[model samples]
Target: MTAPSGTTPNPLEALRAKLAAEPAVVDAAAPVVDAATLEDDYIVCHCTNVTAGELRGLIHEAGCSSLEEIQRCTRAGGSCGKCVPLLTEVVSIELGRAGIA
Candidate 1:
């Protein structure tokens, strides 16, 4: 493509060259969430002050079979909507372990 025969120069290539000269950027390390053991994962919800351990305990103590049951007993999903999925996952794992699935 001859740029209609009269354009002096292309601008895209110049912009690309400028960007290529910049230093490489690095990302900061993120904290790990275990999601397996009850002690390592971060439970952002604190209404129940429920840690992963306490959630596991609730499953055993209340015989919670579903996410709603766990939520009702511990208020894990009562406050914020963020941690509900995680709590559900943990409860599922606990129920599976207890042969209740």
Candidate 2:
């Protein structure tokens, strides 16, 4: 797309405008909840009823390294897929603790 007349459109300005149009989409200062701080019993994938402890067992005992391996073993994020991010975070925490992240 060409800019109007001789004026140049700043890409950053367009990006900022687009982002601003979306309400409460992002909080730059908000802290991310740490997956490591959650208890082992905490449900990381509600769809599969998989807990943090199970993920840890997969990572530490079973030596599962990736989310795909975990999914194949336990079917955590197979349905709906909403819990995938939390599952990933839990996996990341477990892998990080095991020095594999």
Query: Number of the top candidate by TM-score?
Result: 2
Please count the clashing residue pairs in each candidate, in the order shown: 0, 0
Q: What digit string (tens of lDDT, one per residue) describes model 1 on residues 13-72?
A: 766777788767753322234456656345635666778767677677766677777777
> Model 1, stretches more than 4 Å misplaced?
1-32, 40-44
Off by over 4 Å in 2: 1-33
TM-score of each: 0.57, 0.65
Quote the positional error of residue 10 for candidate 1 in Å: 30
The whole-model lDDT of each prediction reads 0.66, 0.82
Error of 2 at 87 (Å): 0.8
Model 2, 17-85: lDDT tens digits are 877887576653333567778788988777889988899999999999888899999999899777777
Which 10 residues in a row give candidate 2 its minimum summed lDDT?
A: 25-34
TM-score of 2: 0.65
lDDT, residue 101, model 1: 66
